[model samples]
Target: MTTITFTVSVLCLLPQSALARWACVRACPAACTCTQEKSCSVLCDRSGLAELPKEFPCEASAISLEKNRLKFLSERAFGTLPSLKSLSLDHNNISFITPGAFKGLSNLLELKMAHNDYISYLHTRAFTGLKKLLRLDLSDCNLFSIPDRIFIEQTALKELLCFQNNFRRIPGAIRGMENLTHIYLERNKIEAVAYNSLLGLGSLRYLNLQENRINVIHDNAFQDLLRLENFYLNDNLLSDLPRLAFRGLARLKMLNLGGNQLTNVSKTWFGDLVELEVLYLDRNQLLNIEEGAFENLTSLITLHLNSNNLSTLPFSVFQPIYFLGHLYLFRNPWECDCSLDWLKQWMESYKLVRDIPCAAPPSLAGLDLSQVVFPAVNGTCVEPAELNLTTASSETTATTENRFNSLISKLLQQELREEMGNGTESLRNDTLLDSEEAQLAAGVGGRWTQSVQSLLCFTLTWLLFGPLHLSDAGFWLYCT
Candidate 1:
């Protein structure tokens, strides 16, 4: 009787143990592959999935649903995936996301929905429970605007990618994300950067606004981004910039302003970028650059001035940048004149100088500026006559005044000698008393005319030697 009872108890224990083992071993979702190499990962990519899978392994930490046909994300679509850390939904046909669609993904760290061009409507509470999310990619979506407060709960987000969209302006959703470090908004239709549009994002370090329709940037637009480092505004329609557009960005390193309509560069635009290392002004309509436009770029390493309308740069523009490494001046209408002699001299100290082609002075046209030998006239550079006049007018007014006075004295002495030679016989016939009375009367009149003459002299001096000085002999009529 005792043996029979023990046999029955063993049989019952065997069935209970088998049932426990069956419950512990979960099955992978249909049409999905599950692996356990490093962690539980599920891949359902390119599977023609029309909707979210009804079940997923509870231990899945990462899932890839790329290249699928998912049209929308229903509420709580991913039911209670507590261990989910990374989810990829790239290259899908997803168009809408209902509220609380990601509510059960409490531990999701990264969410990628890139390449979904039809994703246009995203509820404000679509990402309600993803509080610990770090990176989110919504690129290649045809989104015109992002609902404000969509990321209000994503407090720990670090990188946000919204490139290749139709956004007309920066989304107001990322205003207070203090921990965000990078923002990629390239390839959009953003027109302008309003003042304080990026306020309160103090920890942001990288911002890309390239390949857009941006034309205007308000003053103090980046004032609150004190720790920003890399900024890209290239490939836009920016013809002008506000005085303080990049204020408070002292830590900036790389700045790209290439492929724009900027005709002139201002010194005040980069007054606070003392830590800048690379600057790009290539492919612009730049005709002039202010003196000292790069005076404060002491840490500059690479500079681009290629494909511009510039003929010559100021001598002192690149003098303060001692550590410059690469300088790109190709495809510019460079006039190889004495004004550019300083550039040739400066290039000798660097080993990576690009060949500058001469675009003026038909004799030097098609010649390399570095190889051209500038003729020296009397131990000074032989510049054109018109260039000489420009240099003289740039001098101080005191120097010009002295030169005018010397010329006037010489002319007056010549006139007096000519008059005396022609009237020598007439003067001898006249009485010495007549000459004395005439001298006394002339002296009195001279005092009265002296003040008036001085005023006229100064005015004529400016008209002759000022910026608008004439190059012809017609100006001598004013002196007569």
Candidate 2:
């Protein structure tokens, strides 16, 4: 009777708490197992199960019913999982979702449905009560149209990934998901987006319109997203960006315009984005950047202008991005002359490298460019025969600092303050771009000698000694 009293006390204490505890300790799925503490997880990856068993043995918190041969998700299929949170149904043959299929997935936060073959349409309210949902990924699913009313009632949606879909146009009056933050639309056939199609999305932060045939975007097209941060418009056919194209994006950060066939870009293109950082312009045919073209981008970081037909970069080239880091410039026809002397000095003062791969020709292809020196200023170093000897010594002797070394050392400091944010003294192994030193140009540099010899030949031809015979073979021997 005493022992029975103890057992009755435990049972009579509480009923609901005992039932909840029992649900976790039970054994589940034969092909899968759990630890003694009993944390249930389904690892049915790459399994060819046709249909979910009428009764799954163990209760799990996360389910992986992906990579199966299932054709349809029947009503109430996942209704019994009260604690399920994450579900991955990717790469499946699923073609249909009966109403009430996701009946009790209210606690779910992420749902992955990417890379499926036959999910043509979705049942209305299929994911009805998942109020805590944060991400819904349905990319590469061959979708054409989305029922705008499907997500009209969800209040907590944040990120939506729909890249690689065949959407020709967006639906009208898209539901006002006030808390939505990101929307991916890359690789779609979208021709246009209505001015108000993205209305009521005040929290949207990212909008990717890459790889689409989007030629026309009306003014105020993105007037709804006041807090947008990143916008990608690469690989499109845009001729121009309307003056007010980015009117409402005061907090915009990064903008990508590479791979487009644009012939022009103006200071006004970035007028409204005060906080914008990264800007890509690798392949467009930009003819000019007006002196003050980029004066407004104080927060700009890395600027890419590779693979273009740029003849020169203004001295104020770095005036806008005062805090800029990497300047990708390799393929352009860099005329190594007096005009580019500052670039040589700048490279050495900062000890920076030219990560640019010069594609000049077979003779100079793959030539490491950071070591090349621009011509002397006004041909001064070599013509004065008295100065020739010092310049010669400056080229070869120990302790002689070449223009390349000095320039990279000094400029690398300022560029680093801009590259790696403040207070970082330790640098990575990539400190110098391939460890090029200006010393190679200082000692016995054939190019410098050629300049001196030309000046001597013109001036000394009138001298009694006349011009000393110097073969082109000898000139080439000392330079490399």
Candidate 3:
């Protein structure tokens, strides 16, 4: 009687949560497994099924139907699971999605339909009721175009991946997705970016448009993306960037323009991109950079100008980018001459890296430019006449002073030789005069004695040596 009473009590409480649990377990498909821990999760992948498994739990929160033979998603296919938050239909043969296929999935936040190569058709209202969708991946879909209204009701969508498509132009289809922050459209057949092609994507922050056949970017092509930060346009056929191509992007921080045929860079191409920090312009045919080209890029940090044909650069060309930290100019034909002197000085002063070799002038060929001294590589061009004028004048004055001193020394030596010769001759003549004068003064001792000495010496010197020695003999006689 107690057991019967307990069974009745259990039946009485089966109408609310217990009844729902019992129904979920009974409704699970034979080919699918359902688990109801926090939320009902279904696993129906690789089931060789031709369609979505029948009898899915009504409150299923996550479902995986990947690797199935399902070819189409018909309308209202998943309408019973209004609580579905994640769906994976990848690796299926799905080629079409009929209108309202996911109409009642109001709480769906993530969808993974990637690797569905046969999926070439999508009805306009296929994703109509997914109001809370946040991420969608449709990569490798082989799509030629997307219907503009396919995401009409996905107001909360934030990220989308459409890589490996054949979009020849920027999709103007997703204009109203204002909340989108990331979009990957790489590896497309895009040939041109028409004006206002990406309109209404104001909240977009990261965009990847690399690996395309894009050759022309019309003016104002990126006009509506005001908050965009990172833009990748590498590996394209772009030969030039039209003025105002990126006019509306003020907060952009990084840009990649590598692998193109750009022959020149102009200041007009980077119109007021003040916040840009990193830039890549390598692998191009750039030959010239006009003066003041980087005057507006005040916040630039790293610059890549490698693999170009730049032969020279002006001193003030990089003066505006005061905060620039790294610069790459390798694999270029740099003429190491007078024009590069200032560049050499600046490189040493900033201690910048030298990653390229000189390709001109035989002496500096194949040499690391930073290791070379500019003045030694190319001699100073100062005029020799002006530099040597003072030295030449001083040397001339020195030569004149030495010649005058030599002449004065020679005159003194000649006078000393003549005085020595006169003294020796006078000593011999004075002895003879003294002997004669003693005899004369003893014989006649007065005015007649002096007269006799003077007369005798004057006559003897005149007879022996003419007028040159007579004046000397007269002085000797007077002394005796």
C-alpha RMSD values across all candidates: 14.7, 19.2, 18.4
Which residue runs does candidate 2 get wrong by more than 4 Å? 1-39, 56-59, 170-175, 334-342, 353-480
Query: Where does model 3 exceed 4 Å of error?
Result: 1-39, 342-352, 376-480
- Assess the local accuracy of residue 208 in candidate 2 as a C-alpha lDDT between 0 and 100: 91
The residue-by-residue lDDT of candidate 1 on 1-480, one tens digit each, is 999999778667776545333322355778888777556788898899998889887777899999999998988999998989999999999988989988889999999999998987778888999999999999998899999899999999999999999999999999989999999999999999988679889999999999999999988789888999999999999999997677778999999999999999998888889999999999999999988788888889999999999999867776787558898999999888888887887777675777799988776789888877766767898864445556566664556466555544533443354456734455445443334333322332323245346437546677766622323334434432
Question: Could you give me the TM-score of model 3 versus the true structure?
Answer: 0.71
The top-ranked prediction according to TM-score is 1
Q: What is the descending TM-score order?
A: 1, 3, 2
Give the Cα error of residue 299 in candidate 3, in Å. Answer: 1.6
Candidate 3 lDDT score relative to the true structure:
0.76
Model 3 lDDT per residue over 162-216, tens place: 8997777777667767899999999999998877678788899999999999998
lDDT of 3 at 126: 75
Q: State the weakest 10-residue window (summed lDDT) of model 1.
A: 439-448
CA-lDDT, candidates in order: 0.82, 0.66, 0.76
The per-residue C-alpha lDDT of model 2 at residue 218 equals: 80
**Lowest-scoring 10 consecutive residues by lDDT in candidate 2?**
433-442
lDDT of 2 by residue, 418-463 (tens): 3456433443333542222323223323243443454344344325
